[model samples]
Target chain A: MSEADQGAVVDLLGVLAYAELTAFDRLAEDARMAPTLTGRAALARMAAAEITHHVRLTERLVELGADPSAAMAPFTSALDTFHESTRPSTWLEGLVKAYVGDGLAADFYREIAEFLPDPDRALVLEVLDDTGHADFAVREVRAAIAADRRLAGRLALWGRRLVGEAITRSQAVIAEHDRLADLIVTGTGDLAGIGRLIERITDAHTERMKALGLRP
Target chain B: MSEADQGAVVDLLGVLAYAELTAFDRLAEDARMAPTLTGRAALARMAAAEITHHVRLTERLVELGADPSAAMAPFTSALDTFHESTRPSTWLEGLVKAYVGDGLAADFYREIAEFLPDPDRALVLEVLDDTGHADFAVREVRAAIAADRRLAGRLALWGRRLVGEAITRSQAVIAEHDRLADLIVTGTGDLAGIGRLIERITDAHTERMKALGLRP
Candidate 1:
């Protein structure tokens, strides 16, 4: 890999690892808010999957001879800000955060994985959430909305806010890291292609929201 | 199950469920203190296992037509007190707690499992940490002690404090719940038998501490 490409990959891995760590922390805390033990356990299980991803990325960083902490440090503030801005207040909000926020992040990562090189590319692909989680989240959100139609509006707004924060932080990442920006532009071949990828993610997210009878 | 036996079983399940939930919370928090990605990931994996156990216990409560939260509520304060009194101060302390504390708890539960009926018995049996986790904790604690002989004194004291609190609370549980006490006494079939079981647990624990070069 080119020096610039290697740096970008390192940056991406760092962000992903730290994100996983923080997600686990947040979800574990949120699990306490669950109204039922079943709900709590489900959230906890989801959080656990993030830890596994964190381990894989950290291992890859070690193989690359990079200091994982140092690599993760740069994106910590931005990532923390995203989570802080979108901190869920209630059980449903927590579920929305996990279901909607994580769903979007996973989608973005899936697209990005296509652009990464060899080993890192494969690792990213492997870490992405599978269909089971997405389906579970869909069922949960739908059930929650069906229970209280009023929640649909509030959770939809929350989902949109989460997506907005994610996009804002993502743009900041691009602005601060030239190599990362270069990787995206080079891998996708233009801003339009990247924009189209975002559009696809948004479209799927909208369908999910609408399925739950929420405005996208 | 008899009416009284069912109540006692629910009480035990409640205690175990809450313990798993709180352990998940504490371990997730402790993961942040880890100096390396590998260490952090290790703690996170442990946290995940706790959540899995929580799920299994909660499911059993539901199967019994018990309210999971109600079943878990009675022992909340006592368990909380135990953890608060023995909170770890450092990464090494955290590892020691995870190794020694969890080891003792698992041993106690294994003995108690023989008293439970059918599915609950099987569930408790299955929920105990696999040998892999025990080996990991033992290896980590032993390596830490081998590297720093001075840590032995402090860690040994901590281990004793942990056991002291555990036993005190355990006795309180038995004293307050006649059915549970009866279960234990009947399960083992005499004072001497129970004494021998306690001795076996202590011996194993001392062996573990010795392996870590900590004074038993």
Candidate 2:
């Protein structure tokens, strides 16, 4: 890879590292909202998984001669803003966010991983693997919606808002980092490819919503 | 073991399980206070270890035919109160609490583990094993104290307060759970054994404080 490509990979890894760290933080916080000890433990496990991924990504950055903290610094604000703006107000909202929000982010990253080489691409895909939250969240959310039909409406709205905020912050992050933008644009082969990427992510998000028994 | 003995063991395991769960929660919260990403990751790792212990304990509860959540419920108020009363106000205070506070609690549990049978005793000791937080907390606390001498004084007092609150809540938990109290008394062989146990725990706490450059 060229030096520019390496730098772009670093940027990608850095953002992903910070993203995992924040996800760990947010998931642990959301665990507090769980209605049962079993549910709480489940969310806490997911949080732990995110931290482990964060550690792996940080180690990879160090191996690449990047200062992990310095590399992660630039992307923190955008990610933090994304979480802050979409802060879940209730237990079910939190579940929906964890499921729909994280699923969306993972989908976006997996799309980008198609642009990278060995090791980096492998690491990205591995870290993006589901941390057992999907089935748990789907079961819990579907059950809750079944008990209270009104929840589906609110949660459906919440899911849409989560995706909207995710896309907004993600775009802002890519715009602020030119190397990352260049990598995305080049890897996709054209502006149209970027369009296709968004379309694919949105399609996945709709499928996730439908799985949760919510309107897309 | 007899039914009553089994009940006592269940109570003991319940309290320990809840303790680990709350430790995960507080440690994750405390990670936010860390000054750097490295420090944050360290604390978050410790938090993850706690949750893993919590999972093991909960699984043990299930194996023993006890409802993990119900078994854990009785001790939550006391444990929550202890945490509420000694909530760390700063990063260093948080480190000291993680070190000194958790150390004291672990010491007390180890003393009681002597009465338990093979798997229970082994399980208690294993979950109580240091989660890498000891060295991390010691290094951070001592370094901070060396740089700011005033930290020793406040953290020393903080250490004392942590023990005090811990002792108070522990007594409340014991008083409220007769079977657990019986297990301790029977396990110790006499009431004097309980006194010796407290002394042993206190001594260990003093050693831990000294290790962190704090007054006992």
Instruction: For each candidate in the order shown, give its overall lDDT on alpha carbons.
Output: 0.82, 0.91
**For candidate 2, lDDT tens digit of each residue in A31-140?**
99999988998999999988889999999999999999999999988998998998898989988998999999999999998899989999999999986667999999
Give the alpha carbon lDDT tens digit for every residue of B46-96 in model 1. 998887788899889989999998898877788888888888998878887
Candidate 2 wrong stretches, greater than 4 Å: none
Off by over 4 Å in 1: A1-10, A59-73, A117-122, A131-157, A211-213, B1-14, B56-77, B115-123, B131-153
Question: Each model's interface RMSD (Å)?
Answer: 2.1, 0.7
Best by TM-score: 2
Q: Give the range of the ten consecutive residues with the poorest summed lDDT in model 2 chain A.
A: A129-138
lDDT of 1 by residue, A1-216 (tens): 888778888988888898888888789888888876567767778888888788889889989888888888888899889988988999888877887787788788778778888889999888875626556566777888888888888888888898889999989988998878887788888889988988999997887677656788
Q: Which ten residues in a row have the lowest lDDT in candidate 1 chain A?
A: A129-138
Q: Candidate 2: what is its chain A TM-score?
A: 0.98
- In angstroms, the error of model 1 at B48 is 0.9
- Candidate 1: which docking quality band? medium
